[model samples]
Structures are given as C-alpha cells and as structure tokens.
Target: MSHHDEEIDAAGRADEFLQVFKKGAEFTQDLLKENERLRFRVVQLEETLKEKGHDTVDESPDAIELKKKIEVLEQEKEEILGQIKVVEEENQNFANRYIEIEEENNMLANLYIASYQLHSTLDFKEVLQIILEIVINLIGAEEFGVLLLDEKTNRLEPVASEGLVTSELPSVAVGEGIIGEAVHSGENYFIDSMEGYERDFEKPIVCIPLKIKEHVIGVIAIYKLFTQKDEFTNVDYELFTLLAGHAATAVFSSRMYSDSERKLSTIQGFIDLLTK
Candidate 1:
C-alpha cells in the first residue's frame, strides 16, 4: 500500500528467490556426481565388452544422438536461474523421492523382521503364513503363493498361498508353466501379460524362485490385476530378490534342523535299548 511496504515485500520475494536457487544448486551438484559415476561404469562396461570380443555401439549414429541429448540436458541445467522459489520446489521434489524410498525401506525392514522370526520354527507353518501375509501387504498383489518342489518327482507344490483357491495349483512339473520355469531354471520370471498361460490368470505377474545351493526349492509368485512391462521398477526387483534369498536360506535351514533332530532321536532309542 505504501512505499515502505512495497520495499519490504520486494525484499521478502528476493529472499525466497535466493533460497530456491540454493536448493537448485544442491540438486545440480548431486546430479553431476551421479552422472560421473554412471560414466565411469559405462567405461568399465565398454572395456569388459571389448575384452569379451563384443562389438560396441558407442560410435554408432544412435549413440551420437544420445550424446547430443545429454549435452542439451547439461546446457539446460547450467542455464537455470538463481530463483529461490524454483530451487525450493526442486528440493521439494527431491525430498518427496527420499520420503517415498524411506517408506519402502521401512516396509522391507518390517518384512525382514517378520521373516527372521520364522527362524525359530516352533510353528513353521504359522511363520510361513505370516510371511505370506506380509508379502501381500508390501506388494499389493491380488494373489500369491510359495511353491516348493517335490525333490523325487520335481513337482511344484504350493507350500503356502494367499488369495487363491486351494485346489487351483499343485503338482506342476518343472518348466511347465511360468512359475515352473522360474523354479526349474533358478531365475526370476515376469509375464507382462498372462494371455498365453490361459488356464486362469490374465494379469501382469512376477515369479521369483527360491533356490538354495543352486537348487530351486520353491517359488514366490506375485499376481496383479493389470499387466504392464514397466509396472515394477528396478528397486522392486532388488528388494524382492533379497527377500527371495532369505526365504531360500530359511527353508533350507529349517529342513536341515528337522531332519537332524529326527535322526538324533532315532539313535537315542537304539542307545536306550542297548543300555537296558
């Protein structure tokens, strides 16, 4: 309203602009560090490929185009002005990503805690059920299952499952279905859409094989309502893979302990008879 008031408002706006610019600068610094790491990784990969007698497309037309795009991005990053509000917004974007990741990390940690409690094995079935429940909670999948292979017959039988009918799955031969193939090959599999596996499912699915000592003992399958190639990110893959590894180890250890206790009890019976 007055000259003094107008001057004060302008100064406040200036302060806000400076804050945003600082945040933008911080974001730029982080991006540059990440780019450097990526470039070094690319160089190492290229050298490894060349050593393995593979031809590199680094000098190809597509690569040149990619380089031009990177240059454009760099130019844009440099041209961004020192506006504090804009930098603050950029910082907010970064903060949002960090928060999302933190939430995911907390969830995964909870899953691990629940899984670790299964190590006791006083009631192994209950522990497995809890783990299955957590899987659904974390992944938001429609249905899921844990399938263990019958060693003698190589048949995949559902040891634990959630949201699927009891009679739906069991006794699948290795490499027969998507889940079977993942188990047989000891690798994770994804069916972008389950059109071909038309028995019942029609959704996007991910199957992780639980293998110990190079033998796939079980599988963990996730099913979603819709199908999309990019539904799950690389971070999801990493987390799921780590969980699968823990599941494999837990199953193997439980089996080993149970078997050993059985054998020891049998030997104790013989000792008692001879002593008497």
Candidate 2:
C-alpha cells in the first residue's frame, strides 16, 4: 500500500480507539454508581438486624432471608468492581495509542504544507528563506549554513547562515572536509550521538547534500540544534529527506528564471539601440 494510504488508515484507527475509550469510561462510571447503591442497601439491612436483637433475628425466617440477599448483593458488587478495573486499564492503553497516532498525523500534515510552500515560489531569495525556515522551525537546527557549489571555483560557498558568522564560514573544496565529502559523494552525513554535542567550526552535526538526480548542487551543514531538541526523531529524518529533493529543485528553478530574465533584458536593450 502507499504511504499516504497507511497514514489515513492509522488515523481512522485512532478515531475508532477513542470512541471505544469513551464508552469504557462511561461504563466504569455506571459500575461505580451501582456499587455505591449496593453498599447503601447492605448497610440498611445490617442496621435493621442489629435493632431487632441477634438471637431473635437468628430464629426468624425473614431475617435469615435478608442475610442471604445481603450476601448475594456483596458478591455482585465485587464482580462489578473487577469489571471496572479491567475497563480502566483498557481505556488507558487506548488513550496512549491514540496520542501516538495523533502525533504522527500532525507531522505528516506539516510535511505536506512545507512541501507545498517550497514549490510555491520562484524568486531566488524567497526560495532560500523558505528552506532556512524549514531547517530551523521543522528540523530544529539552531546553527546552520546553506552553501551552494561554485562551478568556477570548484568549491562550496556559503550563501546564507543562521546563528553563525557568514564571513567566518570558510569555503570548502569539493572533496576536502565533512561538508565537502557529502557534496562529493552525494550522501547525507550526521552524528548518531547528539548528547553533549558542542558546536565545532570544522565539523557539523549534520550535513545534507542537495541534489538533482545524481548531480550534487549544494550542502546544508548544521552545527548545532536548539537546546530543547535533545535528539532526532523519525519525523526529523523524513523532513531532511524531503528537503534534499524539494529544496534543490526550488533553488535550481529560481536561478534559471533569474538568469533568463537578465538575458531577456539585455536582448531588449540591444534591439532598442538598433532601432534608434
């Protein structure tokens, strides 16, 4: 089955689980109320027997029948309590599962929105800003840089950065360091252990290579993550994979559009001069 279909099915199951949990909770409440009534009735019967005197009550058939009825009521109360306990446990499990599924669905919705925004713009700067926003807000990166490959220099040059000095960010040769290696091999690089990770100018925590098919175009080097973000989740990895493809296409398309506009302006200027 398709990934989207699986997500939809999971959402449906979450809704069903929630309905069952609600029903179980209502049933538990009814059981508790019935148990309270049974206890009250048992108390009334015992008080009557006490007032009648123990010896007289033991000899009476009516008192003996009352005692048997009290015993049966006590047994029924115990059974109800047991049923309530089991239902409570089942409700708790269902609630937890529903929460997990809800989180997954929310993440999927965010990814869809991000993907849409990435392709909605053709302006170069706007495209870059959207990518940066995805990395910061979605991926939870606090310090990172976007570097595009400079064909003439055969190096990756920093185009934009956050929480870092852009001028201090050095250009990397195509196959030299960690960032460069990702571009050269067209593969992502990330540290498995993020505990106590400190920012390093020479090494980044994560390096994602932006590519168009097999050709690598740029690199996103994240030095550190936000303080609250202790470790990466499955959704974070999915976002990174989405960025690698969609972000690259957006940037490449914008650059081509800008170049074409410049060429068109130059041609128009020459045609006006010839007419004059």
Candidate 3:
C-alpha cells in the first residue's frame, strides 16, 4: 500500500483509542462518587440507630450502652410522674385541713358571741329573749322553747318559744317526756326526727337541761333543726354545754341584781324622807 494511505489508517486507530480512554475515565469518576455517597449514608444510619437506642445489624457496644441509658431514663420519668402525683395529693390535703381549721375558728367565734350576749343583759325578760335569739341564730334551730320549772307544781312551763304552737305543748312531769327526762337526768338528749313520739304534738329533736350546780331549773326543747343543718356537730354540743352550765346562773343573777337595786332605792328614799 502507499505510505499516505498507511499513515491515514494509523491516525484513525489513534482517534479510536482516545475515545475509549475518555469513556473509561468517566466510568471511573462515577464509581468513585457512588462509593463516597454510600460511605456517608452508612455513617448517617449508624448515628440514627445509636440515637434511637436500637441495636443495628452490627450490635456494637455503643448501641448496647445507649439502650441501657434509654431504659434508665424511662424509669426515671415514671418516678418523676409518681412524685408529682404525690405532691398534688399532699397539696389537696393541706388545702382541706386549712379549710377545716377556718371553720373551727368561726364556730368558736360564734360561741363567744353567744356567751357574751347571754351575760350582757340584767333584765329578766331580756335574758329570756337573748337565750331564744342564741338558739335560733347560732344553733340553727327552727322550732324550740324555753321552759322554766314550777317550784310548787314540779311541772315545766314555757316562757319563750318560736315556730311552735304554744297550745300544742302538753304538761310534762319532772321525769316524763324527753324534756322532762333531760331535766331529771341533768343531761342533754338528742333525736334525729319525730318517728316514735306523739304525732299530735311537734316532736322535739333535742332537749337540754339548764342547771345551776347540780340542780336543773329549766329545760330547752328543740323541735326541729334549721333546714341548712342536717345534724348536730361537735361545736353544737359545745354550745349546749355552755347553755347548760351558764344559762340558769345568768338568769338568776340578773333577777337578784334587779331586786336588790329596787330594794336599795326604796331604802334610800325612806332614809331621805326621815332626814327631811
């Protein structure tokens, strides 16, 4: 063959070799990029598994440690929740105790006021009126009567009453009905309602004996409690004790004081007339 033709053939072979080399270089670069991307993805998966406290396929010591830490955190969270619940219950109990103390203080204040009012007057009629007022307002009694014992007949005679028909009251002997029994025993009596007593008369729910020393001179009968009160409380019992111990003494002292004052004034007037 001619030399020019041989040279053209060699150049064509060289051009083909260049194209093959370029293609191989591009394939190698693509393989390197793909390897790097796979390496980064593996790192991401390991970090995610460790953070989630999960054992990956490798099951490394770090994963095991992370799982134990997660378990501890879960237990601590439960303990914290339990502690919070306990604190809440304690707070509720404290609040309830505070309210109870406040109520007791108020009850004591009422008792003091009632006692003060009982002793503040000297008029015989006024003393009876004050006793009735205390029973109605402080003790929350709807129907009640103050009965003074007759020395000669030994029977009860009502002096003051509210919400009860005076004519309906029957004559009670010294040891007969609830009021009479309280007066005889020198103790307080209580009933829930009028279940067994006579239906003709209003049945008294409570009877308190008024006493000076050991002698019961009168009785207080409560027919029905106020609607707001369901039953008597400890404070109510305290009030009954106060009345039982002090009511008769207060009434007697006021009567004696008035009678003495009247006698002294009469004596003074007689002395002045004689001097003139």
Candidate 4:
C-alpha cells in the first residue's frame, strides 16, 4: 500500500472514535436528568397523600358527636344524682315513722295482757281495782273510774275510782251518762277535747262496753284527763276494747258464782226445815 493511503486511514479511524465517545456522554447526561425528575415527582405525590390523610382524620364527624354526647350525659348524671339524694332522705323519714307506730302498738298490747290477767281473781273489790289501775296506766291519766252494773236494780254503781268527787257522778243508772249508753248499747265510744261533761272535759275520754255473750254488762271509763293535743294515738282503742271484753268475762263469772251460792243456801234451808 502507499504511505498517503495509510495516513488517511488513520485519521478516519480517530474521527470515528471521537464521534462515538461524544454520543455516549450525551446519552448519560439525558438519563441522569430523567432520573432526577422522576425522584422529584415521587416526593411531591408522597407529600400530597400525607396532607389528604391529615384532613380526613381532622374531619371525623363520629368523634365530634361522641364528645358532645359524653358532655350531655355527664350533665344528666348530675341531675339524677341530686334526685337520688332526695329520695333517700324521704325514705329515712318513712322508716322512722313506721318504727314509732310499731313501738306504740307493742306497748298497748302488753298493757292489755297484764290487765286481763289481773282481773281474773274472784274477789270483786280486788278485781275492779286492778282493772281500773291498768286502764289508768295505759291511758296515762291521773284519774279513772269503773262502773259495774247491778242486775237487781238495773243500775251502774261506782266500784272503783280515782281522783273523783263523791257528788259528781258517784253512782249513775245503767242508762244515764255517755258511759251508761256504752254499757247498755254494747258499743264503744271515743271522744276527744270535749267540754261540760261529768268528768274530764279537758282530756280525751274512751268509753268501753263490757259485754258477756254479746250483752253489755258493765262500763269501763278511761279518761285522757291530761295529755297533749292529738298526742294519744288510736292504738289506745285496741287496748281498751280488749280490756272491756276481759272485764265482761270476770263480771259474768262473779254474777254466776253469787247466784249459785244463793241457790245452795236456799236448798240448805229447805232441808233444815224437812229435818225439823
């Protein structure tokens, strides 16, 4: 080959190598720019997603309503608590009243039992005095009286008495005063705060009928001659009625024994006559 031809071939080869190196450098720069742009877009999308998620959390309606409901329920709970306190106080007062009533009932019942037992004795004077004392104790009175019916005269006689004058109602007929009505009518009478009667106008009076076999035979007079206004309760009635019934039994027994003794004496007299 010629020398000139060799030199031309060398120059052509060097130019081709430079052109290839320049194209590779430009391709590398383009690829770097595209990678930087993709990285920036991804960062922007991540920031947008974070903001959207924050807005959704802040706008939760259920959480806001729950907070409001909690506040309202707390106010209502306070109101109910006040109401419960009032109810508890009222219940305490009612329980106290119930206890008081029960105590009174027990006292009256015990009094009745003691009185009934005492009047079972056969001695007329002792029995009458014991019954009157029991009635006075139950009524809390300073004065009391008992009137017994005499079947022979159909009249009431004062068998027992406390704090009474011999002139004012010493002895009355079976159908005379308010007490007499109770004895004959077989009914009980209760009067409160009366005026202008034979005894104890300033106090309460309980008139009980002593009945045997449903027939009133005697009068039990209980005078609330001194007590506070409306102080004595109706429990006194229950006790008084029980005493009246027991007194009736005692009275009837005494009458029967007396009649039997009289008849036996008469029979003895007749035998004596026959023997003579």
Candidate 5:
C-alpha cells in the first residue's frame, strides 16, 4: 500500500485503540470506587456489632459475605490493571510507528516541492542557485560545487560552488579522480563512513553525476557536510537521484537558452549597424 494509505490506516487503528483504553480506564476507576465503598460498609458493620456486645464480629454472616465480595472485586481490579498495562505498551508502539510514517511523508513532500522549484526558472544562474539550496538545506552539504563538462577541453569546470573558493576550484579531467570517475561511469560515489572526514579539494566525500539519458553532462562534488549531519539518510539518496536527471535537464536547457539570447542580441546589433 502507499505510505499515505498506510498512515490513514494506522491513524484509524490508533483511534480505536484509544477508545478501548479510555473505556478500560473508566471501568477500572469504577471498580476502585466500589471496592472502597464496600470496605467502608464492612468497617461500619464491625463497629455496630461491637457496640451490641458481639465479641466475634468476623463470624457474623453479613460480615463474611461482604469480605468475600471485596476479595473478588480486588482480584478483578488487579486483572484489569494488568490488561491495561499490556494495552498501554501496544498503544506506545503504535504511536512510534505513526511518527515514523509521518516523517517519511514530510520528506516526500519536501522532495516534490524542491523538484517543482528546480523547473520553475529558465535562468541559468537561478537553476544553479536552486540546486545549491537543495544540497545545502536538504542534503546538509556544507562545501560543494556544481561542475559542468567543458566539451572543448574535455574537463569538468566549476559553474557554481558553496562554502569554498570558486575561482580556486581546479578543473578536473573525466576519469581522473573520484568526481571524474562518477562522471565517466555515470554512477554515484560516496564514502561509507563520514566519521572524522576531512576536506580534500581533489577528492570530494561524495560525487553525484548529472546525466541526461546515457550521457553524463556534469557532476556535483560534495567535499564536506554540516557538523550536525553525522550521516546520510534514505531521502538524501533519493534527492541525489532526482538531481541526477532533473538538475541536468534544467542546467542544459537554461545554458542553451542563455546562448541563444546572446546570439540573437549579436545578430540584432549587426543588423542595426548595417542600417545606420
């Protein structure tokens, strides 16, 4: 079933469980009050018998019957309490499961919103900035760069970067390093352990290649992550996969549009010069 459907189903079950718990608690409270009333009645009967000169109050038939009834009610109360404990544990488990499902739903919603914003603009700089925001806010990347492949030089050059010197970033040839290998093979590369990870300009901690079909267009190299982010989650991997295709298309399309605009401006300028 879908996660949304599962969440709804869980919510229904939790509501039903809560109703049962409420009823059980009320019944237990009633039993306690009844037991207390019966004990007070027994005490009153013993005092009356003593004043009437009856030395053996325990032997009185009314007293014996009332004591028996109180014992039975006490046993029932204990059993109900045990049942309530079991129900409480089950309810706690359900609550924990519900929280997990809710978190997953929230992550999915965030992914949808990020994907929509990525395609909402045709500006090349805006596309890159959107990607940077996704990585920093969503993936918790602290230092990263968006590198596009330079066809003329057969190298990947930095188009945008965060938490690092953009001008100082070196261009990497395809298949030369970790980022290069990801682009060359069109597969993601990441370290399994992020414990005590240090920054390496040449070797990033994680590399995600941006691909259009079978062709790799660029790479996202993450050198460091935020200190608070100890490890990557399943949603982080999903974001990387989404960026691989969507980010590539956005960047490529925006770059093409930018180039066309420049060409159109140049042609219009030439025509105006000829007319003058």
Candidate 6:
C-alpha cells in the first residue's frame, strides 16, 4: 500500500511544474510585441518632423514674436512714404510765395524812384523835361507826348514830343480823341493792342489824365510801348495814378511862383525911380 501512494504523488508534482513553465513563456512573448510597437511609433514621429522642416516638433514663442515684428515694420514703411509726399508739396508752396514777395518789392522800389524825381524841381521847363524822361526811361515807352489844355480855347496841345518826327500834334478838343476823352473824364484809359487806336496813332498804348483836385489840367499820351515790354501790368496802372494826382499840381505851382516874382521886380523898379 505505501509504494503505490508514493508513485501517485510524484506524477501529480510533475504535471503542476509543466503548467507553470508554459505561462511564463507566454508572458515573455507579449513583452517582445509591445517593444516592437513603441519603436515603430518613434520612427513615424521622426518622419513628421522632417516633413515640417523642423529639428524639433514644437514652435518656440520667440519665433511667433519675430513674425509680428515684421508685420509692424511693413505698416510703418507705408506711413513714412505718405509723410514724404506731403513734405514735397509744402516745399513747392514755399517757393511760389518767395517769388511773389520778390516781385512786390521791386514794384515798390520803382514807385518810390518816380515820386522822388517828379518833386525834385520847381522850374516849369525842367518839369516838362522830367515828364519826358519818366515816360522814356522809367515807363519804358517808345513814343509819347505831353498834351496841355489851352485856357483860351480849352483844347489839348502837345507841349513836348519824343521819338516822333512830326512838327506838331493834331488838334484835339477836351472830349474828342482818346487823349481828350481822358482829360475830360479825369481817369486813365488803357488800350491793350495797337488795333484798338490804330486810326488815331500808329500804336497808342495808354492815355493818363493829369488832374489837380477836381479839374483835369493835361493828358500824357503813350503811343507805343518798348520792344521788351509785352503789356502793362498792375504796377504800370499804379504809376499812372500817381502821375495824374501829383504832376499837374507841380507845374501849376511853378508857373504861379514865376509870375509873382516878375510882378514884384516891376513894382520895385517903379518905386526906386519915384524915390530918385
């Protein structure tokens, strides 16, 4: 009975050892499969990094900040271009204003010179000469005449003539020709082209009336302008106004002074004779 029991026990122990060995072999096979799967996943991540053109997978914060700075710089460039255009326009305006101011100063200087020369002398003959000089030199006139109204007939007669070969000017009443019309109206009349007054004179340019207060004393007739002068500007009209108001009065004062001196000399001689 003891031998049979011992044999049965040895057989059961052998069966249990076989079962434990089988389970351990199965666990080792599963661990090998999981290691292969992890290696495949690592290879896939490396390929994705290559396709995106990056050594690492994630983008840093500094790279995003640099992109924003580039956009801001492009916007600033557009603003600077607009400012440059505005500065160019302002420079052009300043240049135009400078030219206008220079022209005004030159006109003022010319007026002052004319005024000083007209009042420098009291002699009647010298005054007539001065008037001719002003027309020929200062006014840049080629042909001109000084016509005075005769008190007896109330007709305009040329007292002085320049750049013309005629012996005497044509007779003109106070309201007849262009010169006479200005004398009667006491205002300056301007003709733009030679075609306007071609019948009266070859090229009558302007006629300025000489007035002393309310009365017109004479007229200054300008037949033709200088070759360089194309037309009369506003500066020329201002000069005409100055001459009309001042020149006539200057001539009248000189004549009155001369007549008074002659009368005084005659009375003094008579008194000396009576005393002797």
User: Can you tell me which runs of candidate 1 are displaced by over 4 Å?
Assistant: 1-86, 120-123, 165-168, 194-204, 223-236
Error of 5 at 218 (Å): 0.8
Single out the weakest 10-residue window by summed lDDT for candidate 1: 195-204
| Native-to-model Cα distance after best TM-score fit, residue 27 in candidate 2, in Å | 76
TM-score of 1: 0.56
Report clash pairs, candidate 1.
17-84, 20-84, 20-87, 20-88, 21-84
Clashing pairs in 6: none
- Number of colliding residue pairs in each model: 5, 0, 0, 0, 0, 0
Error of 6 at 122 (Å): 0.8
**Highest TM-score model number:** 6
Ranking, lDDT, top scorer first: 5, 2, 3, 6, 4, 1
lDDT of 5 by residue, 70-128 (tens): 99999999999999999999999999999999989998899888889889999999999
Model 1 per-residue lDDT at 225: 29
Q: Rate the local accuracy (lDDT) of all candidates.
A: 0.72, 0.91, 0.84, 0.72, 0.92, 0.78
State residue 58's C-alpha deviation in candidate 1, in Å: 65
lDDT of 6 by residue, 1-276 (tens): 599999999999988998888888888888888889989999998898686766332365676677678789989998999998998888899899888888888878877777677778788877888778877776788878888888899998777778864445665788886777887888788875654454355224688888898798888888877779877777778778878877788667666777887899999999999999
- Please give each candidate's TM-score: 0.56, 0.67, 0.68, 0.57, 0.67, 0.70
lDDT of 2 by residue, 177-209 (tens): 899899999998988787777777668999999
User: Judged by lDDT against the true structure, how good is candidate 2?
Assistant: 0.91
Per-residue CA lDDT of model 4 for 1-276, tens digit only, reads: 899999999999999999999999999999999999999999999999999988776678976788789889999999999999999999999999999988877876686576556666766656676676666666655566677778799887766667764245456577667876777678887774555545552222767778776887777665545555334566666666777777778767766777788899999999999999
